[model samples]
Target: MRKALIVGIDYYSHITNLGGCVNDALAVRGVLERNADGTLNFPTPNVLIGTNDTQPVTKTELKSAVRELFVDDSDVALFYFAGHGYLEDTGGYLCTSDSVDGDDGLALSEVMTFANQSSAKNKVIILDSCHGGSAGSNAIARTMTEISDGVTILTASTATQYALETGDGSGVFTRLFVDALNGAAANLVGDITPGSVYAHIDQSLGTWAQRPVFKTNVKKFVSLRKVDPPIALADLQALTTHFPTADHDFLLDPAYEPERSPGQENDPSIPPPDPEKNAIFQVLQKYVRVNLVRPVDAPHMWHAAMGSKSCELTVLGQHYWKLVSEGLI
Candidate 1:
């Protein structure tokens, strides 16, 4: 069983309410639920979300969820928290909606304790809040260095810096994190793991802005997702000869053939209509989406409007065309 507890808080009457934390949490969960190959990773049922619906995450509820996640020895437990984190001399406290009085929210150290006590074969904790790195800096983490070989901790930033939220309704750290899971961090074999994800985020974000923290005892990484690249080299190569010339528009739809004269056709440049070629062209048309991977650039984009010239090939289309021509995908 692969279980995940995703937490994000936007409603905090005590502290400043964050705008993108909830969105960021959902994005991470969404990416984790599926791989780039369109295969399911951790399904919706295995992933628990904590937000306004389950918000004001009291210490008890958070603790219970953490306990439930790691109860099974064979399960892979992953926890992610994106909210405010307050640090004191004692420990770091991740602020929940219920935390009203002081920084007395759910203690991250205790959270680590729950994670450490887990019987899970693999346990991963990702902290996306402010000063979340403090959890690994505590006495327990320092003293008990070899508690478990499968435990991995990934923090958004160092003990002092705040995790930034983007204008696009996602934390900057989480956006790249999700992107890595989706495809960015994938190896040539399509496997994407925690280590690769960390590398992706680390390289993307400079050390001065935010320094992500990582502590892992596992030798082999557990894969989170697989990235399957589209656009087959064979498919692209097969499309070459039919491509449009520099001055001629490749007719997208055979039905859009201009009225042909009976005696003789004036345009030798245009290929005469043929049923066999039209069938293959129609089948190939499936690759061209409007404005995305269109073969033509101008009018009559989809279904061939009356005046729509052969839709021009997009930049991406041209790139693939070149690659195919050069025997590269």
Candidate 2:
């Protein structure tokens, strides 16, 4: 089972209210609730949004929800917060609606404690507020951070930076985050993990923009979401079959190009395409489309086949070949 607590506080009685945090939370909930195929991903995320005229999200409420979220012995427990952040001599705090000078909402260190001690197999915390990078940092040392095993943290900015809003009811960090969850961070087989999400967001932002922070202590990453694969699974698994070895090249001939078959307009002199070879070529073409295979000494797969040249696995293809050989794919 996977559980998520999504909090977005836009209404604060004692401080300047944000306009985009609620939207960000809702957007996150939308994506987390369903996968690309409309299958359930996480059960409808527990969303807590603070808006005008509503009972604001108090520190107690947020803390209780977070505790409940992590207490379960589930596969994954994810907490996402988008709101005001406070950093002072006391450390970083996720501010609540009633935040004051001495009393911020929940301390970042406290939240990390919940995550560190959680029964869940995997704990993921994503913060999209100012000084969010302080989430994993040491309060006293300020230079070191402690992350427990199976815990991962992805924050919007460094300790001193401010998370930006686009002025259109969307945060700059969250906009990219939503995109990442929607497949921008997906691998060839469509798995999206926290590491990939961070990579996507990190590269998308310019040097002058706020930097995203990632901290983790895990043996393997958990897939946060899945999308349609760029290449079919059967084809991916066939990598080893096609190459025999990673560096091996599969020879091609006119029989591999259906276009060179009899009755085709331009290639009457070429031998008709062999049905068996043509079928194999079709799969090879799929690999070529995704950059797993490339024509040798020819500009295109068609040219390689028609000229009786050869095709070889690309660097990425070799990687997949290794996976296939080891039954890892």
Candidate 3:
């Protein structure tokens, strides 16, 4: 089970009510629930969201939610908070709606304590709000800061910087964060993790802007989401549309008639097309290597002499086609 405690506070009795915190929380939940490729990475049911717009996220409720999320030994625990954060001598604090003075907030040190005690092998915590950068640090003394092994913490900004948001209810950090998950943060191995996401977002922001903070003890990355293929949806659709069922064999040599085998994805013959080779095959080869298409049926003659020749859409290809044809992606 992958469990998330998503808390977004927009209403406060004494402080200025933020316009974007709730929206920020929803955006994170949406992306984690389903990646841009429409794959269900985190289900809705497993994500527990508490918003001040509907239900108040009191300090008690926040603590309970945070504690409950880490209870399951088999779960991958994720905690995300988007709201007002405060800096005090104790540490960073995640503010709740009921918080009036700076003291009435969830202490960051306490939150980290819960995170450290979690039984989950993979624990991730994300704080998106002002003063979020203060997390995992002691404000008063030059004490050594530390986190338990297997814990990954990503904050919207360094402890001293404010996580900026627009009046339009969008977080600058989160906007880039979501974009990073949608292929921007993908590494050479085609996997995106918290560390990569922080690096991507941090680099994209200007030097004066908030810098995302990432701390990890785990050597191996745990994939929270899978990015879309490098090719754009429109490009993939353009390629798919090139090979209509009724269309003539566009790529294969006219002499290789009966047998059809698409060669190895990188089969020297496949590259960005020029007049020398058919343009359609170039697209097919790119997408095939990315696992969007495959040889549809057994080959007879036209199939690559020994490999494959003509191609068919794989299940993933069909899914992307549906998304593209309908302009969903």
Candidate 4:
């Protein structure tokens, strides 16, 4: 089972209210609740958005929710917080609506403790507020941080930086995060992991901008979502079958050129096109489109075929071929 506790506090009585935290929470909930194929990824997330005329998001309330979220033994437990993050001589705190001068809200250390002690197989903590990068760090020591096994932390910015908000009522980090979940961070086989999400966000942001932080202690990454693969599974698996060896080149002739097939402009000078070869050529063309196959001694596949040249697997194609040979695809 997968559970998520998503908190967005936009209404703070003692501090400047934020306009986009609630929106960021709602957007995150949308993506986490469903995968790209419209299948359930996680159960409906426990969402708490602070707004006027409703119960305020106090430190106690947020802490209680987080504790409950991590108390159970489950496959995955995820906690997301978007609000004001206060950092002082002690440590970072996820500010609540009841935050005051000296005290903010729940301490980042406290949150990390809950995650570290969780019974869940995988625990993910995502913070989109300022100083969020301080989540897994030691408050007093500053140099020593202990992240237990299976815990992953992704924060929007470094401890000293501020996460930006767009004029469109969305957090800048979250906008890219939503895009990443929507398949921007997916691998060739469509798996989107927390590490990939961090990479996507990091690359999308300017070097001079706020940097996203990623800390994890897991043996293997868990797929947060899946999208349609760039190439069909069957086609991917056939890489080894077609290449035989990674460096092996597949010879081509005029029969492999669909344009040279019968009923089209006939190249009388060349041999008649074979239907079987043409069918194989179609699959090879698909590989060419994705840069897995490249013509050798010719500029294009068509030229390779017409000139009786050959095509070989690209470096990337060889990698996939190795995976296929090992039955890893």
User: Could you say which candidate leads in TM-score?
Assistant: 2
Global Cα RMSD, each model: 9.4, 1.9, 11.4, 2.2
For residue 278, model 4's alpha carbon misses the true position, in angstroms, by 2.4
Give TM-scores for every candidate, taking all chains together and pairing residue i with residue i: 0.65, 0.95, 0.68, 0.93
Q: List the global CA lDDT of all models.
A: 0.70, 0.91, 0.71, 0.89
For model 2, residues 1-329, the per-residue Cα lDDT tens digits are 99999999999988898899999999999998888998999997899999984768989999999999999789999999999998887789999987875246899988999999988999999999999999888878888989899999999999899999988999999999999999999988999999999999999999999999999999999999989998889889988888999999899988888784445655567787799998999999999998899999999999999899999999988888998899888
Ten-residue segment with the worst summed lDDT in candidate 2? 260-269
- Per candidate, the number of residue pairs that clash is 8, 0, 16, 0
**Candidate 1 local lDDT, 1-329, one digit each (tens):** 67788887777766677788878878888888776766777776243334553455665676677777777785578888888888777767888776775367888777777777778878898999888777755454543433367889888987777888778778888988988887888754467888999999999987578888788878778987777734333445555665643233566543344434454255565446566755555545544632224544444333452233465456655665665667654
- Candidate 2 has a TM-score of 0.95
* Model 3 CA lDDT for position 35: 61
Better of 1 and 3 by TM-score: 3
Candidate order by TM-score, highest to lowest?
A: 2, 4, 3, 1
Name the best candidate (by lDDT).
2
Off by over 4 Å in 4: 260-264
Candidate 4 global CA lDDT score: 0.89
The sequence of per-residue lDDT tens digits that candidate 4 reaches over residues 1-329 is 99999999899988899999999999999998988788999878899999763768999899999999999888999998998999888889999998885256899888989999999999999999998988888877786667999999999999899989978998888999889999899877899999999999999999899999999999999988888878788988888878999999899998888685445466577887799999899989989988899999999999999899999999889888998898877
Identify the runs in model 2 with alpha carbons over 4 angstroms from their true place. Answer: 260-269
Rank candidates by lDDT, best first: 2, 4, 3, 1
Error of 2 at 131 (Å): 0.6
Provide the lDDT at 105 for model 4.
Answer: 88
